[model samples]
Target chain A: MIFSYELLAQAIVTGILIGGIFALISVGLSMIWGVMRIINFAHGEFLMIGMYIAYFLTAKAGWDPYLTIFITTPMLFLVGALIFQSTIRPILKDPSMNQIMLTLGLSLILQNLALVVFKADVLTSSTAYTRMNFMLGPVVVRGSQLIAFVGSALTAVFLYWFLQKTESGRAIRATAQNREAAALVGVNVRTTYLLAFGIGSATLGVAASLMIPFYYTSPTVGLFFGLIAYVVVVLGGLGNFIGALVAGLIIGLTESVGAAMLPGSLSRVLTYSLFVVVLLFRPQGIFGGKQQ
Target chain B: MLTVKDLKVQYGAFVALHGVSLSVTEGQVVSIVGANGAGKTTLINTISGLLRPTAGEISFEGRELARLESHTIASLGIVQVPEGRKLFPDMTVYENLLMGSYSKRAKQYRKESLEMVFHLFPRLEQRTKQLARTLSGGEQQMLAVGRAVMSKPRLMMFDEPSLGLAPLLVQSIFQTIRQLKEAGMTIMLVEQNVRQSLQISDYAYVLETGQIVLEGSGQAVLENEHTRKAYLGI
Candidate 1:
């Protein structure tokens, strides 16, 4: 096959658009990890929950996927807080093994429950913009991805402002940096934990809604997305927001470009290979040791 | 006013504070002098609601503090400039001070508090954007004190405020304490620097093995024979 500039441009555009979504997904995980110091294994399961909620809302209420975001994001927040109260908070001081087991077990339970109820068959919702496309010089961009990209940018901006400009946001960062110091400043550390986890889960709602127009939904759909999220967060340096954004884009470019050039599962091989190389060299992430 | 009666703290079977009592009247500089592991920090921490007292009564301005959490106690304007300068390591000096005003009552006075803190430590204003961890040891101590000041603290608790500073810095810190005292701030100081602490202190208590071995006016404790021989090396 001849190497064509058009194909490269196409892959780059596609990668960037999807990269925005990946960044959104990992930002939630980053906040949770930073404030709580818990690697939430069920992070992707919550995304799955978001997708399912969006799918059903579109199917049953004839709602657009975008409209479902208004419902799904807040719903996911409540879900995250409830789950924390029930499971994570009780065993917070327990050993790492207990936390891993409980979170992994929670993930398995969510997946199987969805499988039992939704029957594992793939589902998708079609909006008017689903199959639309826009041609720009040498590359064509999907309308759905453009919208998702816009949504991702807006969400990121809001999150950045929230963390920087608000009292609660300052409390979260202080708690993340030094828990005892945060208490000295009169921050309710436990409440901050709950808020961080809830906001983290809520981010998945926005991502799921954006993807529903172009992506399929199933209990197992989160498998690859979750794996990608883990890579993005690790590459961004755990708990670092800007790191996740840049790393997410890097992963998106690798996956899309690899898929365009290589066939079958070889694309994932490329992504994981990059992950390994990154881990071996600059494991602190793409930003080195820079703090947010 | 803050008062503790028969305060007892145990770490598992180990008794850290064995039935101690102390009091700080409003606008008075009260120092708790003790040797290392003599329960200075334990007593201060217990007052700040960090540790549950096994058996005790702590009242602050007529309110019970034994059932409150550390953050709640902090919100009541009982802030502590903790030992070792526990600043938020990754945050900027400005941000750390901003966090000190997170409580509602302190939040309203954020502007004035920032001004007051800056007045107390002009060096902190010079390095406002630098991260707390990057500051020199003395600067970190000043930032710690500045942060507590930003909380609009009605009662400031100092736990070894001069623990890890240079001799020069120690003089500067005690000087700052003297300034706060002039401003009529109530303080509870825990220190091993017996001479300097007692010099600025209005009232003082000497703790030995978690018990109050001596309690009197600062001049009285400073002039005592045991303090001079054991702590002051006179």
Candidate 2:
């Protein structure tokens, strides 16, 4: 295979745009994992739910996909809180194996529920700009891809600021580092756990709403993004927010360029191979995450 | 400023603390010294709301603290520097200190608090940008204390501040504790280093088998036959 500057630039641009969406998806998963000490197997299903909600809202009420954030963000936030309270909270004191199994069960239930309701059919938002693109020099960026990338970047920044600056935000950071210590410092850690989980799920919802305009959604749509998200989170470092952001972008570019250079299947294999390498060498990630 | 009456903590069928009672007056440095598994950590942990007592009453500043969350207890100004420097290893030295002051009041006076902490342990200021995990053992202990100090607690509890340090570093840490005492901070020092703990403590309690076996003025406890034999190695 031969390489040209034009092809390289286009692949890189595509990678970056895709990376933004991956960032949006992975950060929530990482945050929840960091603070709650739980791996939410249902994470991808929540994204699927968000995409479906956006699809139906647009199909029925004629609402814009971006505008659906107003409804979906808060809705998902509430749903996340409820899930934490009902499902996650009860098993929190249990062993890690129990927590993982429970969340995995919840994910299966959610995905099948979507399958039952939406009938496993692929759906997408019929936005006018879905196919629109603008050329920059010899490269071009699809409007929807740009939106997914920019939206995720902005949301990641907002979350970073919230975690660092706000009192509740500080509590989340504290809980992530030391739950008992955070509690000792007057951080309502249980409440913070619920909030972190909620925020994590909402981030997925945000990603889903953004994604529907750019990509198609099925009951199993989460499976596709889920694999990528798992890669992104592991590559970025477990529970490191900023690391996830950087890793998302890096994975995005790698996937796009790799696909362009090699067979598409080989590119995915190469992408997954990066995860294995990172885990083997730098398990802590590019940015040092939690020490243990 | 604080009182623990009839405190009993149990982990399922196993009781870690049994009817423990103690008190700390305002601006006093109280020490609780005991052997491993003697419930020193359990007592502090219960008081800090990390563990719920099966039966007990803990009151701080005239308010009941039994049902309050640990963070709520912290907000009431009862902060504990937990055993093992539980610093966020990935964070910088400065960030670890900032986490101590996560409370609203601490945030409001962060600059003043940071200055005071730096003054006490100037080494932290020099390595403010370095990752906390990279710090030496003594430096990590300083960072732990420095982090707790940022909270501006009305009563700060140190849980084995001298656990893992060199002899020289241990001496300096004890000296720092004395300085904090002179600076008028209400402190509860829990340690296995009995001799040093007794020396710095204004009042001391000896815990054995989840109960207080002895309580006295610091010197009196130091002079006790048991203290002399078991801890001071006299």
Candidate 3:
């Protein structure tokens, strides 16, 4: 219980690494929201499904969790697209309330389905690197967490390039800015919506694959992490990718440092309190300018 | 290159374009002059495939476009510089121009089209890095026109391009339209500025309450007693 500079440094390092993983999880949610303006309530369930996919691939098929990204990402992409076409598209012209209820319903269905299929038992992919850690001066960093951090950073870079540099990416941004204008310029707004949702779901696959090595998988596991992601997305501004990344780190640090300073039960309350303060002063978010 | 026959568009119980018919030949500037809520926007929107006609036909280059989506219509070379200068505000002027060539057919000629746009509006070239929202009203209109040109449109429609501009800027916009016509771009202009539009237009139509009341060569329509009295303030 003795306070030490080493403990504080370790907490900050671990928070940052964990924040990277959180960034990966929330970026997709941010993208879907940005392009389609749909707050996908089922986003957490998508991550949960990704975790289950990675779990099976590693535990049963003896595949490396990281390598399963190739399968999990595509599978989730299909799932995301299917969900969009079947449920979201029909009510697109309806009020925002309809969209919200539909996604919330989807979340519930996915959660219960996972409980039915994967059972209530908690599962983890105990890879060789799961328990491995390396000492960085006085701070020790877990190998799996470090890998997740690196993967999240790589995903962010790739996503940034994809949205900014590629033609389709530009189309997505244009659609996000103005759907009617995008259509006027011959950008297929509907297709862009599908692609955004698919990519958003796919990022969860990457997050899941990276996460299972160090974390447990359960039907409700996504709820906990997913709540943090919403906080991160809100803190970062709803639709800003880079903001989500920065906010993810902020949230991670807040949780870890807050837990160290206060009771664990009260740390989450502290995080929400920060979110409320942000909402009150800068509703557009810290990095969210007038633009997306 | 564009023709509409007996077009009737409705929004629920309200009829916007009541059996309106119009045509734009290749290499011509056709102006539709009307007061606000006189079905000018309805006709433009219908032609651009943003709104489907309740009854009638729209054919572009001899092909029917009644059932096509807006993007499909746009890809087939019928682009509209929508009302209010709907440029992607967050995007840079350069990026907005690039987005204009988003169609498959237009993509190949993007470089040349950009050069052409830059040549037409040197100010846009200078403000390439500036966001569309940051540009002045006149520059935004130029950027909107520039963005439409990027698509390499065969038939470019302008919806009140001179609306909400200073008188000087409006004159410049009309001058730009004339220059575009000189360069052989087909234009369909919808305007409230009857005299200026009639002066530059090859042919003109006068619409009132969702119906075309008069149609003729621009000079003939300009000199007509009814057009002069109702629209020209003579």
Candidate 4:
């Protein structure tokens, strides 16, 4: 119950790093929701799937977490595209509730499938960077958190460029705004949706790979991060990328500081409490008005 | 350079467009006028590739559009400004125009297209950074037209551009339509505003209950007793 500057600084710094990771993870959800107009309840399953893929690649082939990016990113992209084409895409014109149900079913299917493949047992990874740390004033920067922070920032930059500069990126944005208008303007909305899903899934893949060195993984791993990510998506605004970025970091800091201040149970309660408050006050989120 | 022949459309058991046909020669300003639910939008939707025809053929620049995709149709220089000014509400005025050329125009030309759009609608240029939803109704209509013009289409379709405009704004929009026609752009205008649409149209087609009730030169159609009494309210 005593106040300490070192503890406070440490808490804030840790929150920022974790927030970066959360931002990177939630951005895809935001982008998908913005363009496709679906909440994608199964997003957490995709994250879990990425983690397992990283685990198998590292365990079997002795690949580094970074190396797993090349493999898992593309593979997850394809997986995401397939999920859209097979299930999500078919019911795209249906009501929003139907789309939500489809993705929820997808989540269940993916979680169970991972349970069958990787089992309910927990798994983790080791890297030279995993245990490293940096000392700044009274605060410490753990290696895993640093990597997650830097990696998440880099991924966010990449996604921003992809959405703004590239033609395909613009097409995806157009599809998000007005699918019919996009079609009328010569945008292959179908392809754009497929590409957006792929890109979104690929982001999760990167997130999963980065997480292996730091966090334990199981079939339910996605549920933990996925819940945080959903909170981040709404906090940042449903489909706004920059909103997600700011919201992610803010939530990260809040959660970190909360943990330092209260017991773990109370910290979660605080986080959710903040979520409800933010929802009530500004349901659109901080950067809600901005488009992806 | 556009021809729609016997285009048929159905909504469940009800037929909206039963073998309706229209044609637009190169650089001609053709208008289609009908009352509410008279299939004007259905016809435009079919032509723009938003809706598929149950039967009939649509050909633009000699390419068969019956089975082609909507984007493909647009890339071939057939663009449509839909019934509502479907501007991306969250995007800036400039961003909406940029999205107009999103599929066809490249980055290098984006600047020029933006300039062209700005020149066409000075109001949009004045509020370039403003979100589209914040624009006035007339400005939004202008933004919609400006957005479509960014594509530089071979054939452009307008669906009720004056749907919610004031009288003065409607006159300005008609003047702009005339200017576009003078610029040698082939346009297919769909409107319920009969008098103004007929005034500027090179040719006019009157649709009644999804059928072509009258068709002729603009002057002739304006003079037609059925068209004048029912539509022009003369």
Candidate 5:
């Protein structure tokens, strides 16, 4: 195979745009894992739920995909809080195995519920700009992709601010770092857990809204993104917000570059291989996990 | 006032506290001194609602505390500077202090409490922007105590505050405790540094093998022959 600067540059640019979205998806998953001390197997299903919410508002009510973000963000946050208060909170002190089983079961229930209600249908949002494209030298940028990238980046920045500047956000980080100490300091650790989980799920809300313009959704759409999210999180290190962000970009870039270089769908294999190599060498993650 | 009467904390088959009783009145400093595995931490934990007592009564201001949750107890004004500091390693020193004032009771007084903490430990004031994990050992301990102060605790508890500090740092920590004592803050101290802890204590209890074997005014407890033989090495 031959290499050209134009081809490589174009792939890199496209990878970055998609990578931004990928990173955003993992941020919520990482935050939940960090603060709640649970894997949240239903994390991807939360994304699916967001997609459905966006789907209904856009395909049924004729709302713009981007405009639906306001609804999805808060709605998903509430969904996350309700799920946490009702189901997850009860089993919070149980062994990790039980928590894992509960979340895995939740994922199944959510998937089947979607299957029953929405049927085995692949739904795509037909927005006015879905097919729009732009040219920057040799790089062809899809308008939907650029919008998704920017939307994802802005949401990530907002979440970062909430974690850094707000009291609820500080409580979340404090709970993540040391639960016992957080409690002793008068931090309502349980409430912080609820908020952290909600914020985590809320990111998926924005993500689903952004992706629907370009991406298709189905009951099983979560399965693919779930795999990508876990890979990014592990590569970044568990409970590491900044690390997850970086890993998201790297995974995106690598996936695109590998696709351009390799034939067929072998690019996925490259992603997994990189994951394996990172796990073998730096199990704590690329950034070295936030040590207790 | 904080009071624990016949508190018996057992972990399944293992008994950690065997019917211990103690009390700290307002404006008084009480210390519980014991050797390793003497259930000192267990007693403090039960008082703070971190551990449940099989048979006991713990009350603060006449309100039952044994049945309450840990955070509820903290919010009610019984804050413990936990062993090993337990500082949020990832959070900044200021953020850690902010967390200390998270309860409704502490929120209003946070600004003044922070100023008081900075006055107590000027080193912590300088490192407000630094991560708690990055601080030196002594600085971390100071931050821990400073955070507890920010909680506006009615009865502050310390569990082995001087465990790993150097001799000089331990002396300074004791000095700070004395200062807080002078400020009319009621305190419950658990320490292995029996001599120093008792010196600052108004009343002291000697815990041995999950039981309180001796109790008296600080001077009397210090002068006890048994306490001297086993603890003081005098």
Candidate 6:
């Protein structure tokens, strides 16, 4: 393959588009971890569930994956709320290790459950837009990827606006800052926790819907994506909303460009090396420490 | 407007309060003066629903508040400016004040409350964009009180409002309390500064080792032999 400026530009564009979807996946994890102060190891399982839902809606019922977002997001929100209430809430005040173990256990159970029900089959949903592409000067953008990029950017903007301008959003930020003080000021901290967790899971649903058009869905589909989200979250600074989006783009560009320049395994090695470098020098993240 | 009767609080076999009782009437500045480890903070915390009393009744405007959550108790117009000035450190001064009016009842009057807070603490108004952690000690204390006032509480409680401040700032804080009392805002104050607290309070209670040893008008308590010797150092 001859090295060309057009090829490099195309690769960068594809990386950015994919990075937007990664932002959509990671934002929810950041929100839950930020507010509740729990790692929520099962976050990837929620994404996996979302992917399966999108697949079923599009593959079995002949519904468009884009339209399936409306159904999956709310369903995942409920799932997030239920998981928090049933598993996470009881151990909220217990030792940090207990919360970690519980969420880790949840991740195992969910992955195994999917294996039993879905039978480890790789499934994907295809629409007319999935194969369509548009050219912008020297760069080419896939139709579905463009939609995902636009949707992810809009979601990030909406979330930022909510946190900055809305009353409930401010309450959530207050709780994250000081729970006892928030309660003193009449903010129901428990409800804020539920809202954060629910919203976080709903974002996963949106990501899964966007992803199903181009990616394969299986029991362990969320494993790699979830791991990447953790990297993005850390790279952006844990719990920083805008940081997650920007870090996602950086990681996406790094992966795409690395693959073009190096072997496939070496590309992943390059990404993890970047993670180590980020952890060493800027442990707070590229943006800063924990800010909503 | 507020009454706590036979309140007892304990932490794992250690008693913090031993059946203490106190009352604050409408528009009165009631002060609870005590030395360190005298259960003053515990009493305030219990009333604010942060700590639960093993035995007692707490009523505000004749409604029982013994079993309500902290946020619920706060929503009922009993706001506390806690010890150490627990403002949200990461948030800006304006955002911290905005969070003070988190309850639905206070939300509608938020603009007016902000104006009132700005008038009371002009420095806070100037520092609205500054983070709470970046403010000076005195400014942070002012922000704490200003944040409390933004809730439009029928009864405002201060837990050591002047704990860590310069002498001049302490006088100013006490002056603000007096002005609040003059404005018909019922206030309950807990302080280690016996002389200043008694000077402004309509009524005062002396707490020692988790028990109320003396209760009287501020003047009478200020003149007592025990208070004069121990707390007043005169």
Fnat values, one per model, are 0.81, 0.72, 0.83, 0.79, 0.87, 0.92
Q: Candidate 5 on B77-128: residue-level lDDT in tens? A: 8999899999989888999999899899999999999999999999998888
Better of 2 and 5 by TM-score: 5
For every candidate structure, what is the RMSD over all alpha carbons to the true structure, in angstroms? 1.3, 2.6, 1.0, 2.2, 1.6, 1.5
Candidate 3, residue A106: the lDDT equals 95
lDDT of 3 by residue, A94-202 (tens): 8899899999999999999999998999997788979889999998999999999999999989998999889999999999999999999998888999998899999
Candidates in order have lDDT scores of 0.92, 0.86, 0.92, 0.86, 0.91, 0.91
Q: Higher DockQ: candidate 2 or 3?
A: 3
Quality class of the docking in candidate 5, CAPRI style: medium
Off by over 4 Å in 2: A1-9, A136-140, A257-267, A277-292
**Cand 1, B chain, TM:** 0.99
Model 2 lDDT, full chain set:
0.86
Which digits, one per residue and each the tens of the lDDT, describe model 2 over residues B1-234? 899999999999998889999999988899999998999999888888889999989998789998988888888788888899788776678778878888877788789989999999988999999988899999999998898889988898989888878999999988988988899999999999998898888899999989899999999999999989987889
What DockQ do you compute for every candidate structure?
A: 0.80, 0.55, 0.87, 0.67, 0.71, 0.83
lDDT for residue B182 in candidate 6, whole number 0-100: 86
Give the alpha carbon lDDT tens digit for every residue of A60-123 in model 5: 9999999999999999999999999999999999999999999899999999999999999999
* Candidate 6 per-residue C-alpha lDDT over B48-160 given as tens digits, one digit per residue, 9 for 90 to 100: 99999999999998999889999999998899999998899989999999999989898889999999899889999899999999999999999999999999899999999
TM-score of each: 0.98, 0.91, 0.98, 0.94, 0.97, 0.97
Model 5 residue runs over 4 Å out of place are A1-4
Question: Model 6: per-residue lDDT, tens digit, A1-292?
Answer: 4677887888799889989988888888887888988888888899999999999999999988889999999999999999998889889999999998998899999999999999988987778878989899988889989998998888888888888889988988888888999999999889999998998899988888888788889999878887999999989998888899899999998888777767657989988999999889998999866586
Worst-scoring 10-residue span by lDDT in model 4 chain A: A283-292
Compared with the true structure, the alpha-carbon lDDT of candidate 6 equals 0.91
Runs of candidate 3 exceeding 4 Å displacement: none
Model 5 scores a C-alpha lDDT of 0.91
Show where candidate 6 strays beyond 4 Å: A1-6
Which regions of candidate 4 fall more than 4 Å away from where they truly are? A1-3, B104-119, B122-127
**Cα lDDT of model 4 by residue, A210-239, tens digit:** 888888889998888889989999998889
